[model samples]
Target: MVANNTGPKIQQEKATVSVMIYLYCHQNHHTPRNQLCNECHDLLNYAMARLTMCRFGEHKTTCERCPKHCYRKDYKQKIKQVMRYAGPRMIIHHPIMAFRHIYKNLLSK
Candidate 1:
């Protein structure tokens, strides 16, 4: 089988989502550090699957900026909540990734 070589942007997107979900789960669900609750785990898996199959592939924009809405309604809402809660905290918890994401957004505009 051939390997699917996703670019750095896709990798970063996965990492960003993972971090966001972890932060949300840790704070709101009281999940253990570096661990995810079942609900969050399921959401993360679903999100990753959606990302992997993204029509834009490596050229994909951030979900917020993307023209397409790939997620199911409930999962989309859950992820939005996670992002809303975790976005600000990202600067404190993971500054490099946070700033990179911000920089990318600026460049994309």
Candidate 2:
């Protein structure tokens, strides 16, 4: 199968994930918005790159639930922490994107 390029949907989801992680880091780690600490910035950059490189494209599931593992172990742990801390908060802070993410994952399953 030809690999699909990342599309707007994936881009939007990546943006939402970045925002969620940023919010979590800001609150818990006291990082500034203009400058995420090096680790968090690296994580965000890595996640965005992974999202862009994802083979499943539009059919991609939530990374946590996905059968295909993409992130390295250390990055995976960091992302898990970010998601765990910010996932629920996304419902409040980014209702539409959050609901869409949940709905997409459920449907994909």
Candidate 3:
């Protein structure tokens, strides 16, 4: 039998179960709320951690300056677009129509 070693990122993802637990206990229970809560919480935590760890420069991007947290070389075009627009747009804005953008993106792909 082989043991599968999880990376730090995977551990962080597992840590995000807290958010799912939180949202679940909120009492607005929906059928898919479990998945939503886990994924949403994980993303919130990941995004927050990414922001907190950034070494952002005036000229350089969070992705460029802190590639570990922000860069996705495999999704080059998507990362570039997100870095250029979504990165800055998300700073002051709450997640209002962000769901629409995400739906369009994921549904299309």
Candidate 4:
């Protein structure tokens, strides 16, 4: 994929996943450093991989509204849990990205 097409989506996914990890880890698990535990890290990597392989690339819709669900069953559930937990928190913690994400979803519909 072209960098132009992939860059923003990749960055958005990174930010979203980062927020999810922060919330999920702080509440449920203890880590030595400000880093995700192995499970969350794996989930993040899986999310990134899915973003990279997205068929729509630059023109992609939000994954939630996408017609094709690319994630496997377990990973899909995990990601949904993350997004459900982090989506509202993002407005408080990362307002700009959260607004952009919400706007994008609105436009996609």
Per-prediction TM-score: 0.92, 0.88, 0.27, 0.83
- As a TM-score, model 1 comes out at 0.92
Off by over 4 Å in 1: 1-5
Of 1 and 2, the candidate ranking higher by TM-score:
1
Residues 6-97 of candidate 1: C-alpha lDDT, one tens digit per residue: 77878889999999999999999998999999999999999888887777878787888888898999999999999999999999999999
Count clashing residue pairs per candidate. Answer: 0, 0, 0, 0
Residue 66, model 3: lDDT of 38
For residues 23-106, could you state the per-residue lDDT of candidate 3 as single tens digits? 433333353533444443544455445434444322222234334445344444433433455433432452433343344345
For model 3, state the Cα shift of residue 73 in Å.
6.9
Residue-wise lDDT of candidate 2 within 1-109, one digit each (tens)? Answer: 5454578878777888898878888878897865588888899999988888888887777886788998999999999899999989989988998898888778776
Per-residue CA lDDT of model 4 for 11-102, tens digit only, reads 67666667766777665677654678889889878887777777777777888789999899999999888788778888887788789889
Model 3: number of backbone collisions: 0
Off by more than 4 A, model 3:
1-36, 57-109
A best-first ranking of the candidates according to their lDDT comes to 1, 2, 4, 3
What lDDT would candidate 4 get against the real structure?
0.78
| RMSD vs true structure, all candidates | 2.4, 2.0, 12.9, 2.7
Compute the lDDT for candidate 3. 0.39
